[model samples]
Target: MIVGGAIFQLCWVVRDIAVAQQAFTEQYGVADWFSIPDVHFGTESAELRGVPTDYTISVALGYAGGQQLELIEPRDGVSLYSEQLERIGPGLHHAAWVPDDYDAALTEACAAGIEIVARGRFDDIGMEFAYLDGGSIGSYIELMRLSEEMKAMFDHLIPAGFTNPWQ
Candidate 1:
């Protein structure tokens, strides 16, 4: 249990965000989808396998009960999301945990020989995340660190622009 936190989010990588959102909404009954479009991770903001890389993606976040559901569509450049979509098509990609002690959890995971496949930060939102190779597990595991401001924003995410279709 390297992550060692309650899983709060589930993410799927898709070819088309709008199609994925509609299917998820209809099938899972997610209340609303909050779109975060054209998220750019500059070379300074992200890394792939410890090498700085630039990429773009669009994400839609929704809620079903306490769990947050996410749909990610790669827009440009190379990333784990795009690679997974190419290798496996579309389906569950990762489960995420926000540990109470983010740094400690990350340190421990690294100390335990877990491979960090990707990592990035949204500086404007004071948030960072890492994707860990799950090894024997089929899907990757994500660890997220969110600032208080980011947490507050996430609390009201659904209401900010509810039902925002992909763009």
Candidate 2:
């Protein structure tokens, strides 16, 4: 049986990662947790079933109220986020959740009628993700699971605002 996890992070899709990061820093007084350049994988080209085509993705991480915030920018062609940005102008993209049995959970979600919008594996992070159609929810949803190595990496590189006062 697949054990579901809580919402891990909320993603904000933007056109400019630097501007977005700076805005967040200035507005919320939060520093960037980490920023990664465009990372490519698998085929050089692909298509989103119901969404637009995209090539590369650039991501930045930040924190607010004890929750991680992911910022994504599509570098290649049009993408799901491109449409989202056109409609809403760079804001919340999706809420992410982690599941113990990612495959099983995906299967169950499909069985229950949630459509898979997009999916890919982040080789550097040792994690895979799937975006689900939200229907009436007005937002996409992400399902993700991390490998042990990735978990170790996260533990080693703590985000800036995570200092423990007692320590």
Candidate 3:
């Protein structure tokens, strides 16, 4: 899972991770940016376009005002994030959600015809997440599983500014 808080992060697809992180910090005064480079979804289990493909992406997380902002840079492969970046350039990619029941949420989403575009797991932290096509709501809704470590990290993501995230 990428984030653990109730108010999930807003993701932006960017071409450069360092540039985006710097922009967020300089333009919005968002600090404590936690970054991960080269996150790969393993083959066989994780499918991209219905086939096991090697997809890698880099991410930076920081709190702006009271909201969480994530900047994602697609590295190598063909995931939905990469596709969005290629089709529309860098912009708002998705809004994430951490549900109470992973399987139940997925089942409910499927029942509503909210298809799972991409799902992956990172065994290193027992973390897994899925990107659900927002059926009627529009865009993509990312559902992430909550890990203990992630929960701990998310606890620090509080209201950073006296005003709002955009400030």
Candidate 4:
């Protein structure tokens, strides 16, 4: 299995994003949350276990150290967040890895028994991401194919004077 990239994001499914983001900011000192609401996965473009669905969710992102802490709240529909919250309560959902070689990283994750659970394209950013269910570990792993546009956007969020991650 390919194993060079490091985990970049820690995602959680929360019952109330507004409250959760506040809690995280206060408790962990992870401030400056960038809120993104009504994330739309087109009717035919998004899928869960191969079944298409027009699921939407709200998300708030904050950087803790060098890793992103994402808090997600399920909207008025059935979605990955909804299912996870129903079965496991509001807690850690997935950890994302931004790999240089997206295809090879996916192949390695799959070879290690991480099965694709949900996938969709973010048309606005021209990037695609997939969530793999890390079966035995009982958590999910998201593999994001970082496009140039996505990189540029995230780079802007770098903390303080450490704008360069490579430094």
Compute each candidate's TM-score over C-alphas: 0.91, 0.81, 0.84, 0.90
lDDT of 3 by residue, 1-167 (tens): 42344546799999988998888888889877888899777695587645777788898888876677898899988888889887888888888877777788888877877678888887667668888876667678888777777665665565533332112
* Native-to-model Cα distance after best TM-score fit, residue 16 in candidate 3, in Å: 1.1
The better candidate by TM-score, 3 or 4, is 4
Please give the lDDT score for candidate 4. Answer: 0.81
Taken over the whole model, the C-alpha lDDT of each candidate is: 0.86, 0.73, 0.77, 0.81
The clash numbers for all candidates, in the given order, read 0, 0, 1, 0
Query: Between prediction 2 and prediction 4, which has the larger lDDT?
Result: 4
lDDT of 4 by residue, 1-167 (tens): 55455677789999999999989989999878889998877766788887887878999988887777899999866778899989989999998877777888878777887778988887777788889887778888888887787777777876764442322
Give the Cα-based TM-score of candidate 3 against the true structure. 0.84
Q: Which whole-number lDDT from 0 to 100 does residue 13 have in model 4?
A: 97
Instruction: Report residue 84 deviation for candidate 2 (angstroms).
Output: 1.8
Q: What's the C-alpha lDDT at position 132 in model 2?
A: 87
Most lDDT-accurate candidate: 1
Model 2 clashing residue pairs (backbone): none
What is the lDDT, from 0 to 100, of the residue 145 in candidate 3? 77
**Winner by TM-score:** 1
